[model samples]
Target: MLLATINSSIVLISLPAIFRGIHLDPLEPGNVSYLLWMIMGFLVVSAVLVVLLGRLGDIYGRVRMYNLGFLVFALSSVLLSVDPFDQGAGAMWLIVLRVVQGVGGAMIFANSAAILTDAFPAHQRGMALGINNVAAVAGSFLGLVIGGLVAEWDWRAVFWISVPIAIAGTVWGYRSLHELGSRRTSSMDWWGNLTFAVGLTALLVAITYGIQPYGDHATGWTNPWVVAGLVGGIGLLIAFVLVEQRVEDPMFSMHLFAIRPFAAGNLASLLAATSRGGLQFMLIIWLQGIWLPLHGYDYESTPLWAGIYLLPLTVGFLVAGPVAGRLSDRYGARLFATVGLVLVAGTFIGFLLIPVDFDYWVFALLLLVNGLASGLFAAPNATMIMNSVPADQRGAASGMRGTFMNSGSALSIGLFFSLMVAGLASSLPGSLRSGLTAQGVPSDVAGQVADLPPVGSLFASFLGYNPIQTLLEPTGTLDSLSADHATTLTGKTFFPQLISGPFHDGLVVVFLAAAVMSLIAAAASALGGAKYVHQED
Candidate 1:
């Protein structure tokens, strides 16, 4: 699980180097599709497959499927490290391979919790799952530093590092882990599975693209294709629900929703995961794009240093996760999970109050609070979810829980990104135009530059490129300008200083939305009722 999550996050931190290695400019309008695919493909595939895969684990041996996952993950890591093309083809190769890797990830994620639940008693599930949850949250944080350090040398190393871990885990699992869970022999619900997979995939893929610019519009939410996808996907999902009801052996046991703890816990899980994903992306952009540069970190070093500085967050999670999990075991999950989410909501409010170029200590303090709160919520919430289901349904329930969480993360990249982009759009153009003009850029060139989508600037900053350089180099504006003016325009401080206000405005919008989601998650957690052990059938 640690390896799976670490691999996911490594890709996030190593993206700039990865894109460069593949000879793709992520900021290029035409290439944004590639960028979005690179990020979304793995997530979309995992979200779509985990529920089905979990059912497979229940039908077959959980350990068998898990072993296959390890082997597949190792092979995919090898292929990713040895990507053999450049430019668009290279991007496509990585994307396709990542989807395959996500297949492996789904297998592991879908079954791991169920296996653990089967092996441990109900009273101890929270502690065990809490430790597991720590692997997830902490691994994501650790991957940032690992990817940053290795990507500083070679981007391929990021993928390479996963190989040994996959191999070791595969061997160990095969050697030590056994299938302790009850296996259900049932016919496949091919129709239910197909509709669920295809419908969810279409819905998520549409969400990924809906945030991109469409013609003259700020977002593609109104694009005819997007609208079609939305309606079609929702229609298909409705059909899937209907199909599940009549099936002899439904892949997704919709009856699980009747369990108040299971249903409300999933609702809380989804919203909390969405907030968590959005916070990670938003903070990365804030640090890599603006804050780190302002603090005198070089563009080339920001990715690594951004990860390093965020360690306090990991520290808080590490300190809080296991202890909270153990505490939840004795005290029951409801109070802990609800209070944890409340704390997380309060921290998001803290984010809204902070400045874009915030002091390091203040920023670190906010992150620590967020991390502690999240850790408190994750394990206990996950335990409640896995414990609420019958023994026979545990695998499916774990998969369902994972689906909600992973899907939420996938949706966050789109939903929060759109909110942040829309917020920036209201003020970024004017800021860009005036800032460039003030720096001795030709007004015509400045206007033209400002006219381009703000995503480019946002991405340029994320990739640790000077936004002025990225925007002007293709236009010959840099060549036409005076040396002093060009130097001033391309300096790190210039772009960070210019974008700070607009970025802050965007942060306000994003964090407030996250806070609202967190609060709602708290309400959902509260509705999950007092803890009670599921009686195994």
Candidate 2:
């Protein structure tokens, strides 16, 4: 779980380095697809396959499957580090390998909880799962720090770090981890798995691409392919529901939803995961693009510092998660989960009210509070989810929960990103154009740069690179300008100051949306009633 979560997060902070290593400019209009694929493919694949893999673990043996996951994850990590191609091929190699790694990630995510539940008695499950959950969630934050620090030296080191961890885990798991969980006799639900995978993939891919510019529009929401993907994906999902209802052996037990705690826990998990995912994205961009640069960090160095600055979030999660779970076990999951999400929502509001270039202490405090809230919510909610389902169905329940959470996280990239992009589009063009012209860029050149979608510019900053110099390079205006003007134009603070207002506008939209999501999650969390542990049938 630590390895999976770490790998999942490290890539994010290391993305700019990875792109550079591959000789690919992810900010290029033509290469945005690679950027999206690099980030989204792992998440999408994991979301799509976890349920099926969990069912497989139930039918076969979880330990066997988990061991295989370690093997696969390790092998893929090695491949990821060894890409020989450059440019498009290099990016494709990494993206494809990430999908394979996601396969391994799905296996680990689907079965890890169920295995722990089987190993621990009901009385101890919450504490045990709490520790496990902290490792999973905390690793995400830690990975950012690790990625930033390591990628400063070698981008391949980001992937390489996973190799030794995977090897150790594979050997340890195969040797010591027994199938403490039940191995059932159900046959594979091939049809159900197929439809669900294909359908969900199409829907998410559509959402992913829908944020990109197309047809001279700020977003591709109206593109024909996206439209077909959305519609077709929905139709297939409907078919999947019908098929699951009819199938004697199903990939996911929809009947789990009849259990109020299970249903509510999952709904809350999805909402919270979406908000949490968006929070991570927005925070990184906020720190790298605006805060760090404003504070005198170089564009090329912001990624590392952004991660370092966010350590308070990880520290808060570590401090609160297990303690909350232990308390929840004594009290009830509902109270902790509900209160935690409300805290999260409150923190989001706090973020919304802050200025673009706020004080570090204020930002750090909010991040810590949000992290604590997430910690408080995560363990209790997860415990409730596991405790609500029957023993025989725990694997599927875990898988279903994993699917919901992972899918929500995946979808967040599209949802919040589109919202942010929309917010930026409203004012960024003029802001960018006028800002550039004032800096001695020709009007035509400035206009051309401004017309490009803000997503690329935003990503360039988020990735710790300045697009101002790159954008002007195409205009051939750098040579025409005096050295003083060129230096001033491409200086570290120039782009950050130029885009601060527009970025803040987008941040308000994104952060507010995240707060609403947390509120909804809180409401759903409240619906789970009190703590009631399930007994094996």
Candidate 3:
């Protein structure tokens, strides 16, 4: 679980280095798809496949699928490290292999919880799953720190470092683990799988493209292809639900929704995961794009420092997760999970109160509380959801849980980015044009730069590049300016200061939305009822 999540996020912090290593410019017009794919492909594949893979685990053996996952992950990591191509092909190689790695990730995600449930008694499941959930959630943050340190030394090392751990895990898992869960022999739901995959893929792919600029629009939401994808994807998913009802063996057991704990828990899980994922992206941009640079850190070093600074968030999770899980075991998940989400919402409101260039201690304190709130919610939520299902269906339940979480993360990219871009669209161009023209840039050049889609500037900042330099260099605008003007145009303070106001405008929308979602999740958690475990018939 740790390896799967760590691998998922490590690539995010390491992207600038990885693209540089592959001789690709991520901010280029033609190369943006490559950048988006490098980030989204794994997530989409994992989200699409977890349910099917988990069902396979139930049919075959959880340990077998899990061991296989480790092996596949290890091999893909090796392939990723030894890229023999450059430019598009190199990016393609990584993307394709990363998809393969996502398969492994899906396998692990689907079965890890089932395996633990089988190993532990019901009374102990919360504490055991709590520790597991902590590793699962906290590992994403840990990967940031690890990726920053390793990618600075060598981009290839980012993938290479996972090899040894995966290999050791594979061997140990194969030798030491055995199937303890009841196996259900069943036919594969080919039609159900097909619809689910194709439908979910279309929806997620649409989301991937929806954040890009479309003609005169700030985002691709108006693009014909994106619109078709959305409509088509939703249509297919509706068909999938219908098909699952008629199928002899469904990949997703829709009947499980009849269980209150399972249904409400999943609803809460989806919303919470979406909000959490949005928070992660927003924080990275907040730190890397604005706060760090404003505080005198170079763009090149922001990734590392951003991760290091987020340690307080990770610490809060570590401190709260296991304890929450154990307490939930005794007192039931309802109180803990509801209170935690309420705290999460409060923290989001707290974030809305701070300035972009916030005091470090204040920001860190918010991050810590958010982390603690999340940890308090996660294990108990997972325990509640998993415990609600019959023993024979644990694998499918685990997969269903994972699907909501992974899909939420995938959706966050589109949802939050669209919101941010819209906010930027309203203010960024005017700011850019005025900021540039005042610094001696030609009016035409300044206008052209400002006219470019705000997404490019956002991506540049996200990738830890100087947004001003990226925008001005190709236009030859800087070369025509006075030395001081040129220096100020590309300097750290100028762009950060210019964008902060618009960025804050966007953050207000994003964080408020997240807070509302958290409150809704709390309500859903409350509806999950008292700690009642499913009794086998």
Candidate 4:
């Protein structure tokens, strides 16, 4: 489980190096979408399939499916490590393999909780789950450090690093992890599977496309295809719910939600995930784009530095996770879960207080607090949800929990990016116009250039490209500027300096949204009540 968690996070830190290795620019207009998808596609696919796979595990054998997951995950890692193509083709290959990897991940994610629940006695389940849940969250933060280190040395090493660990896990799981749960001889829920998959895939695709520009607008939300996806997918889901109510064996057992703890725990998990998942990316951008650049780090070095600077977050999680889990085992989850969310809300406010280029020590301390808050919430919430389900139903319930969590993460990426980009679009052009006009450029050209879509600028900063070069290259005005003026215009420092005001505006909006969501999550967690259900001995 630890190794799996490690692999999940390690990729995030190594993305810049990975792009360089494939002879691709992460900021190139055509590649920006690919880069975002590559980072997120594995998560999306895993979120969508876990429920189906979990149901399969219940019908077949948990150990059998889990062992197979290790094998598949290992094979995909090898494929990813030895990626043969260069340029766009290589990037495409990586995306495809990543989806395959998600398959393995789904199997593992779907069953790990059920396997643990089967192995641990009821009294010890919280501690065991706490350790497991912490590994998952810890992996997310640790990925930054590992990614930064491995990517700095060699990008392929990041993927290769997973190979040996995966091999060992596969062997160990097969030999030692036994099937302790009963298998149901139920038929597969084909209708439930089809509707759920198609519905979810459509909705996620709509969200993904929503972040890209559509026609003259900065976002694709109004596009016919995107609207269709959103509407059609939702319609299918509505139909799926109706179908599930009638099915003899439904993929998502709707009745499960009738249990207060299970339902409330999942709702809180989704909201918490939505608030937190997208935050990591926003924080990375905040560090890499504004803070690191202003603090003397070159754009090329910002990715690694951002990861390094964020180490305190991982430390906080490590400190809080197991202890919270142990405490929850003795006391009910309501107190810890509610308090943890309150702390998370506090962390968001803390983030709002600091300037983008604030002192590192202060920033790190806030991040540590955030991590601790999240750790406090995670284990107990997960334990509460799993405890409420029947032992045979744990796999499906866990998968459902994962789906909500990962989907919220994916959705958060879209929501935060959209909000930030919209904020950028509103203020960036005017800021750019003023800055360029001050530098003696013509008002007409400056205004025309400023009015260009903000997506390019957002992508430029995101991929560590110099936004000024991209902004100026298309106008053909760079050739006309004197060498000194052109240097000033295209230098690394120019665009970050220009867009800081607008960027901060967008960041505040994102933070506020996250804070509100966290508060809601805290409320929901509290509503889950004090009841704990343990299957009869």
Best by TM-score: 3
**Model 4: per-residue Cα lDDT over 176-206, one tens digit each:** 9889986777878899999999998899888
Candidate 3 wrong stretches, greater than 4 Å? none
Q: How close to the true structure is residue 24 of candidate 1, measured as C-alpha lDDT?
A: 87
Q: How well does each candidate superpose onto the true structure, as a TM-score? A: 0.98, 0.98, 0.99, 0.96
The best-first sequence of candidates by lDDT reads: 3, 1, 2, 4
Per-residue lDDT for 208 in model 3?
A: 97
lDDT of each: 0.89, 0.88, 0.93, 0.84
**Candidate 2 ranges beyond 4 A from true positions:** none
Q: Candidate 1: which stretches are off by over 4 Å? A: none
How far is 536's C-alpha from truth in model 3 (Å)? 0.9
The sequence of per-residue lDDT tens digits that candidate 3 reaches over residues 126-192 is 9999999999988899999999999999999999988999999999998899899999988999889
